[model samples]
Target: MSAGTAFLGSAGVLLIVTLIKLWALRKNPNDPILRAVCGTLFIGALLFVTAAPPHLAKINNWFGTPNIAAPIVYCILTAFDAVNIVLLIHWRGNDDAARTRRQTRLCLTAYVAVMAAIVLLFTMGDAPVERLRDLDTYYANTPFIREMIVLYLAAHTVAAVTMTVLCWRWSRQVPGSLRLGLLTIAAGSSSAFLYDLLKYTAIVARWSGANLDWLSTHAAFSLAGVSALLVAAGFLIPPLGQGASSRWGMFQQFQRLKPLWLEIQSEIPRTCPKPMSWWRSMDLRLMQRERDIHDAVLRLGPYFDASTGKRVYAEALAEHAERRRARGEADASVIAGAVIAKATARPAVSPEDRWMLTSTEDPEDLVRMSDALARSPRVQAIRRWAALVGSRG
Candidate 1:
């Protein structure tokens, strides 16, 4: 995608996520740390929107000043950085509640002062033409404008560097999803630092009578755009990505267990006396299927023969060992399949009296066992066991 498109897309995604988070926050309005985090994300989204090309001009016109969106964008970005610092402090949790609040207040107060300085400096500059996408480079040498650029850059540099250090240290301490998210955010912060340094250097070059406008106008802005996208992804991955991964896993388990559930369910109709309507979620369906399978196992308990289970398990293990598939994973499936096959053949004693010893909390073992039932050897062995049981009866 073009750079503008990428920026808009990233900003749009952040806005959508921020709105969702805000809606959730309505349920727990008293959560201070969570509110700070959402505030950081929300301000970052607005910064991106104001920095976008089309919105930049509209914002400038609304403010009735040429390139006026520049100060507004910087102010929002300053707010974003301040809130991010607050979030980091809260996440670190090394400071007491009062100390954390003091540190947050200090950071916010400093950024707000910087934001005011930026607006006052911009207003003092004499530029009348709008330079939406190139405001910094366009005013690189102007008196008040040059100082304004340096002021915003200095504030951004400090924030970015602080975040990089904090996030890197915290990443080493955290594990799993939190660690991953922190590292990603650190990378984004590092990118922001680079963008600020480049822009500052370019402005300084103009003061030294060197025309390095390309660095500030093109390269640094490009880096800033990339940093924005990365920061959005970093913020989103831990919560949204993990949730999506969980849902996807549940759907997969639901699909995988279906064949086995349907097979056993055919023989024990009362196990699932009623079917759920199609409109229900797959996650709910998976839960229902698991419950039905458990009920069916109980109904088939009288048919279960312990000796048959032992024999089938031993034979399957030996056969799979020869095929080099009887290691860690295959071993469990062999045992579960044999037990389930034996249960499918024995005569019913009392349906209400028996229960499977397997854990209902984890369905992985049950899924494996169901998968093994469809194997040709296991199916044939179950038939033989049923015939033997019939003859004995």
Candidate 2:
């Protein structure tokens, strides 16, 4: 691909990521990692746009100077390198906040010095002709221009190397999407380092009176877009994957509790939530359902009979059920018996019965009991017996 096409594609992807991070930033304004990531992506995008041949030429015409946009792009690129380093530092975590801040300040100072040198060299040198695509090779022998090109390239190389080493090591210590993301970043950063290595080779070839301009102009340019896209995906994966995982977990819990909730909801209408809006978040619906279930359990707790619950539990064990499953069946029969007794119980609830039900009020336990309520033949027999007892009353 042409340099313009590669650069433009990288810019577009970075811009989209930038907008997403910016929206996330509004919600978490004080998160250092988010802030640093946003800065890195935005600056990287800006660097690409400014370095595009057409945009660079327009910038030169606007300033009435030949190749003036080169220094401008170089400075922005240096800033991008600085922010990337800062982001990696932040990502390393705040185990020692003071040390992290010190490291970040030092990195910023060094990169800012590099940017100043790029500007100074541009002012001192003369590039009378515009060569947007081949500036590094064309100015390889020029005094100040050579130093300027070398400075930015050196700065970029250092950032890429540091990113690769740090991410590879960090990836091993982490698990799940974070691990995958860091490994991807390591790969992308190494590609960036290789791109610069080729650029260096091309410049040195020019110094030796040999032509290897394609190394800098073509090979490295192709790698640049792939590098940018990979790096963006690396940063994006963890958060997006974690968000998806959380939503799926909530959905599963909602489905698990749904049937049991519906079974009791009609009888205790006052404990139920009103018809919810279609647009409510899944978590909110889950919270509402959980609240209703807990409330219903407490309200129904008064009717529990300890003797009957113990007898049902003993019978379940005698039937050769696993202890865990037997416990669920016992709880299911107790709840079934309670449903019938709720209408007929006249005396105040004894503390023993309330505590018995309270001990089994765990949400996970409720889910198991609900499952048994729906599927257990043992619980179905108990339910029929309870119905007969209710009729006699």
Candidate 3:
């Protein structure tokens, strides 16, 4: 891809990622991890925007100084390196607050030093010629400009290596989307390190009187652009993937509860409005269904009997059903009996006469009970027995 296209594409991706992170962070504005990641992404986008050849020339002209964009780019890169390290340290997460603070301070100190040195060297150096795309090679032999270039490149190169090693290592320890994101970050960091290496090799070759400016002017730029896209994508995947996964799971849970929900609504009358398209968040639907199920459970509480559960459980085991499935079957029978008793208008048992299974009546256990209620023939038989007795009552 062309350098302008590469730079622009990377910048656009970063800006989009940054906006997403910012939106997510608003719920907890004090989150260090989100803040760090957000800052790094924004800075990276800025770096790419400023480093593009046309932008570099425009910036130099804007300031009315020859090669002035060089120092600005270097300072921004140095800042990007510093912020990235701070993010890594935060991402790793140390338990010791003091140690984390100390480490963060040290990284910031080094970053400020690098930024100051870049500005100082640029001021001291005289590069009157305007060399936008090939400034590194063009000024490779200049006194102070040489130091400024080396400083930023060295900092960025070190950050790249650190990012590659840490992210790759951490990826092994994690699972799911986080692991994938970390791996992508490692790839991007590796590309960045390669770009920096090319720049270094090209500059050093100039000192030896060889022409290898294409390494910096072409190959390095392309690699840097590729790195930007990879890193932005790495940051994006984890949150987006996790959000999608959670929504899918919630959708499944909502569907699972439907049979039981329909069973309750069929016998008992409650006015529930159909959810509109905008009201169709899976989580909201799941929560509302859980509330309805729990309400039904409470109304049918008096119909549950302790002895019936034991008898049903014993019968299930006698049939050689697996332990968990047998328990689910037993629970299903008790719930089924309650539904029958309520429908048949059986008189309520006293509070002291009521009994429930050991299982907490949470949504998870309810799902299991509902699954069994929908499928188990044994539960049907047990409920038939209860219905006969309930008919007598």
Candidate 4:
């Protein structure tokens, strides 16, 4: 097969892989910006494959030109990239304050102004028909076409450089997995810009009456295909890799906590000089708190699906209820207090909590109890139990 065909096939395979991975990891409620970025990259890859390969065909067929489809697809891809950059800035600013929002808007406006300038420079002296025909011709012999190609290359070079710098600066604040992915994306985009430069140089050479067969139309098409695949892969790999890493981290964390939990359970009998019933009650309360904290941490990652969160929460609630049933009121209040402490210590509630309490089941009673304790008028009441349970933290 031809180089262009091979590149396109590879790109298509990678695109499928990227999409599947994204689908699996896109359930992260905290990652709306990431989801949008991945979706745009996927769409951009599709457009690149659809519109970029046609310039290679020697035959003048319907598919060969790609017609208006090429420019439209390019515009869409460009818009997505621009928006992705703006979103990155907003995200880096932590989505806070009116000033940050204004900064994001201003950055986006500047990007648009630059794009408009590039377009104007590229189309300055050319008639629409002539420009369109020139675009269709794989190897044009016109000075204006060469200049336009150079201008396009320069614009892309600037964009790639800016992205590289931005990604570098942003990497320090992000997690390792995300940092790796962003750096990969910057590198891939830089490669694509270099490919554009090569193509522009070839066009310039041809305009100067030089026959550089190595920089063929097919070569440029293949380069584009490779670049698109790399870009898509760069954008897609991070979320999937991060999710996997988080799951492994959770498992390790659980293993580390296991011994501590066992020790806490074993120590209760020795520490409590009261009756067996009292020791059992305290043990149950500690277990309930441990379970809540564990569930909350597990739900923090992207691995858990929508149902997983609810399932975990329900299971914890059931375990608490079972303890209550077995030990009666002696353990019930202590267990409830422990649950409140653990839940409040969590960074944020998962989406599952919102759905479970509001839509799925009647969790309002338990929620109200927790809220009441949190906002109690008497700090001494909780403090009394706090000393009894030795739950200072």
**Global lDDT of each candidate:** 0.72, 0.82, 0.82, 0.49
10 residues in a row with least lDDT, candidate 4: 355-364
RMSD of 1: 5.4
lDDT score, residue 200, model 2?
99
Model number with the top TM-score? 3
Per-residue lDDT tens digits for candidate 3, residues 1-393, read 766677877788788979988898898799988898898899889988998888888998899999999899888877877877798798788999899989999989988998999999999999999998899999999999998999999988888898899998999899999899889988998998999999999999999999999999889977876786677667667877899999988888888877777766643436655433535777887877777766667667787866667787888888976776667677778778777777888876666656665433566767777787788887778778878976787
Which of the two candidates, 1 or 2, achieves a greater TM-score against the reference?
A: 2
The lowest-lDDT stretch of 10 consecutive residues in candidate 2 is 352-361
Question: lDDT tens digits, residues 243-299, model 4?
Answer: 788666544443443432332242233333333342354444444534543343233
Q: Higher-lDDT candidate among 1 and 3?
A: 3
Better candidate number, 1 or 4, judged by TM-score: 1
Candidate 3: lDDT over CA atoms? 0.82
TM-score of each: 0.73, 0.88, 0.90, 0.51
| Order by lDDT, highest first | 2, 3, 1, 4
Clashes found in each candidate (C-alpha, N, C closer than 3 A): 1, 0, 0, 0
The 10-residue segment of model 3 with minimum total lDDT is 267-276
